[model samples]
Each structure stands twice: as structure tokens, then as C-alpha cells.
Target: MFKGLRETIRAYQERDPAARSGVEIFLLYPGVHATIYHKFAHFLYRHRLFFLARFVSQWSRFWTGIEIHPGATIGRRFVIDHGMGVVIGETAEIGDDVLLYQGVTLGGSGKEKGKRHPTIGNNVMIGSGARVLGSFKVGDNSRIAAGAVVVAEMPPNSTAVGVPAQIVKVAGERVNYTKELDQIHTPDPVSLEIQKLTECTRRLEKAMRELEEKRHEDI
Candidate 1:
């Protein structure tokens, strides 16, 4: 248990440059506190102590401003940065080394029965205000851009962006950029498509002008 706590603190220190001291992190970091609280809550939940589990979960949410259901399964090195307003639904399964920023939601679409939430694979980074709804697998090494609403499944090493998020980068050879926290560098498919349309319109206008000039000369 001490080892896990040490590892969690280390992860925060390594990932967040703003982290100054271990004492500060232990005393002030809500993400760290939430995770620790969840461990106990999860244990009680597993033991069929539903009321106690919920009470603990609610207490954690109130104290940390991060709502993580007791039924959610979280793996090692799960980092939630500036974790206020972050919600993890029951039945949601998060793998190791997953990084989540503020306002991220791993929620359901409707009133579903089993496996209603998302299953996030290892090394996945979900940016701030990103909504990953429904039962889908966010594959390992994938990055979900800030404010992206991902309703579909993402493959490994891909980058999802835009509303109803589209996979901008597929699982293949590309620039080896490892920093998943680079949310600003994510490609916008909507903007790219708009640019293409603008270029196409310009080319068509040029062709129309050329044809009109030729017709006048012929006359």
C-alpha cells in the first residue's frame, strides 16, 4: 500500500512540472486523495458493502470534486490532473497509466444494464472536457483531444478529435511524438475540411472566370 502511494506521488511529480514537493502533493492534491479514497471504497464494494461503498464514494466526491463510482475499475498509475468535475460511471474500466484532465466523463448513453460505460486501455490520455460516452473501448496509446465527444471505438495509437470525435491519426507510422498531454497540437478535422472546401471554391471560381473570358474573346 505504501509502495502504491509512493508510486502515485512519483507519477504526479514526473508528469506535472508544477509539482513542488511531496508534502504539498500529499496534503493538497485532490486526485491523489480521490484515488486513495476509491481504493477503500472499491474494496468495500467488492465485499458487497454497497451502502458503505457509496457513502465513501460520495464523501470522496464531495471532498475532491471528482466523482468516481465505487463500481468503476481503475488500474495502476491512473492519473487525473486538475480533476474537478471529472465523472467515472459505474462499470467503467480504466487501464494502467491512463491520464485524464479536468471535466472528462466516462459515462453512459442511456439507461443501460451491464457494461454501460467506457473501457479505457493502457496509456490512453483523455484531454480536458472530453466526453467519452457509451460502451466503447478506447484503445491503448490513444489520445482524445480536449472537448472531443468520442462515441465510437478508437484503435491503438490513434488520435481522436472534434465533435462525435473522428480519428484524425490512425495506427501507423507517423511522427514519433510521445507527449500525450500536448492537447493544443491535436489536428482539427473540421477546420481541415473547411479549408479544403474553401480551396475548391477558389479553383472553381478561377475556372469559371477563364471560361467566361474565352467566350467573350470568341464572340
Candidate 2:
């Protein structure tokens, strides 16, 4: 238990540059407090103490402003930076070394019965205000950009950006995301589509003008 606590504090220090010391992180960080509360709540839930588990989870939510359902499965060294407004649904499963920024939601799209939430793979980083809805797998080492609404499954070592989140980068080269959070400057699919349409329109107009000139000469 002490080892886990120490590890959690170390993770916070590594991820957050502003973290001054281990004592400060352990005493002051809401994300750390929330994770500790969740461990106890999850234990109670596993023991079939449903009401108690919910009570503990609700208390944690109230205290930390981070809502993590007791039924959600979270792996080791999971970090939530600036964790306020973060929500993890009952069916959501998070793997090891996952990092989440503020206002991220792992939620359901509808009233689905089982597996309504997303299964996040190891080493994934979800940016702030990102909504990952539906029962899909966000593969290992993938990065979900800020405010991106991901409804589909993402493959390993990929980067997803924009609404209805499209995969912009694949397994070609590794990116050190821990160094910085580059939410902006990602490729915009909407802009690309518009450019393609504009080019097509110009080509059509040129062809039409040439055809009219040929017709007049023939007459």
C-alpha cells in the first residue's frame, strides 16, 4: 500500500512539472485523493457492498470534483492532471500508465446494457475536454486531442484529432507526448475536404470555359 502511494506520488511528479515535492503532491493533489478514494470504493464494490461503494465514490466526487464510478476498472499508475470535471463511467476500463487532462469523459452514447463505456489501453493520453463515447477500444500509446469527440476505435500508436476524431498519425515514429501537450496544430480534416472541393470546382470551371470557346470557333 505504501509502495503504491509512493509510486502514485512519483507519477504525479513526473507528469506535472509544477509539482514541488512528494509531500505536497500526497497532501494537496485532488487527483491523488480521488484515486485513493476509488481504491477503497472499488474494493467495497467487489465485495458486493454496492450502496457503501456508491457513497464513498460520491463523497470522493464531492471532495475532489472528479467523478469515477466504483464499477470502473482502473490499472496501475493512472494519472489525472487537473482532474476537475473528469468522469469515468461504470463500464469504463483504463489500463496502466494512462494520463488524462481536465474535463475528459469516458461515457456511453446511449442506454446500452453492457460495456457502454470505452476501454482505454496502456500509455494513452487523453487531452482536456475530450469526449470518448461508445464501447470502443482506444489502443495503446494513442493520443486523443483536446475537445475531440471520439466515437470509433483507435489503433495502437496513433494520434486522433478533431471532432468525430480522425486518426492523423500512425505507427511510423514515436512521439514524446510527456514533454509537451500539443493539442493545437493538428491536421484539420474539414479544412482538407474544403480545399479538395475548391480545387475540383476550379478545374470544372476551366474545362467549361475551354469547351465554350471551342464551340464558338467551330460555329
Candidate 3:
């Protein structure tokens, strides 16, 4: 009700520092306006008023590029930064202190029913255009890299990156993805090192197989 509205406005202020006034936020920022309206629409949906809920949600989506389903359960202080084309599925459960950039989709991996959408943990950051699908769990305090397509489950405080997103590093690590929206750079030296290690493993396995054969022949 009024609580959600106040919270949404506060979130806008905390999220976007460039927002000079609440009037500017209400008028100019589509992201803020969209979230505010979605909150009411979602409430209506929970109360079994499906038709009106959908009408308001569709209206909000038309005005803003963000498409938040009324059935989706979003936590307090939820912020959609640059929320164009963000599609949160009906079954998606987003935890508190979560951040999502433009074009992020929390969708289903399969056609089955019952909790098809992804369950995101608290303090997690989903980068722009990242697609985290299925009923997988995204661990708390994790960062999903930009444009990553994650279908597998992520570990707590770990970072998932690349297509079919791999958990590259454990907790207490860092990734430099500054200005990635402008142009993403590949051939990362850090990941390249990991790739080289994988190649070395293959070579070692081949060498071990040859040695084992020679030893067996001698026997």
C-alpha cells in the first residue's frame, strides 16, 4: 500500500544519485515510475484481482520498457537500474538488496510447472542482458557478469560469468567489468590462464595413458 510506495521512492533515491528531486524521479525516470506502479499491480494480483492487475502491469510495461509480472515476488528495496526490457517471470523470487540492470531475464529453463523461474538470493547483482533461467538458485552476495546466460546453480559469494555461466572464482575474489555496457572485451587474461590450465590437464592425461600402456607391455 502506502508503505510500498514510500519504500519504492526511497529506493529510487538510494539507487540513482543523479536524481535531483522526487518530482524529477516521478516525471522523468521511467524506472522509478514503473516499479511504483508494479508494486500496486502486484498487490492486486495477490488479492485475486487478476484482470485489473494485468491491465496496470501492461500499461506500465508500455510506458517503461521494463516488464515485471504481477505474480513475481520482489523483496523490499528492490532496484532495477536502467530497467529497459527487464522481464521477471511470474514464479521468480527475488530476495532483498538485489540489483538488476537492463534486459535481465529471470525465466524458466523447462516447460514444466511449479517454481519454474529462478530464485535469486539477497545482495546479488545481475548485470545487463544476463539471462538466469530455470529453477536454479543464485547464491547470496554473488555477481552475475554482463550478458551471462546462467542455467546452473551458483555458490554463495561466487561470481558466475560467460555463457552457461561457469563459477569462475570463489568468495573474496574480484572481476573488472567497468564500462562493459559500452563494449565488452573478451580474451580475458584471467580466464585465459584457466583455459591454459585445462589444456595442460589434457596433455597430462594423454602422457599418463601412454606411460600406463608401456608399463603394462613390460609386465
Instruction: Indicate which candidate wins on TM-score.
Output: 1
Over 1-219, each residue of candidate 1 has an lDDT whose tens digit, in order, gives 888888888878877879999888888999999999999999999999999999999999999999999999999877889999999999999998888999999999999899999999988889899999999999888889899999989888889998889997764843222344688778888898999999999999999999999999999
Error of 2 at 12 (Å): 1.1
lDDT of 2 by residue, 1-219 (tens): 778888888888899999999999989999999999999999999999999999999999999999999999998888999999999999999998889999999999999799899999988899999999999999888889899999999988888888789987665765556775676766677788899999999999999999999999999
Q: Tell how far residue 156 is off in model 2, in angstroms.
A: 0.9
lDDT of 3 at 69: 86
- All candidates' TM-scores? 0.88, 0.87, 0.77
Which residue ranges in model 2 land beyond 4 Å of their true spot? 193-219
Ranking by lDDT: 2, 1, 3
Best by the lDDT measure: 2
Candidate 3 lDDT over residue span 1-219, tens digit each: 667656666767776667777677767777777778888999999999999999999999999988888888888767787789999898899997677889999998879988899999887778889999999898887778888899989887777778877775554743322213222443343677789999999999999999999999999
Worst 10 residues of 3 by lDDT: 174-183
lDDT of 2 at 17: 90
Displacement of residue 125 (Cα, Å) in model 3 is 0.9
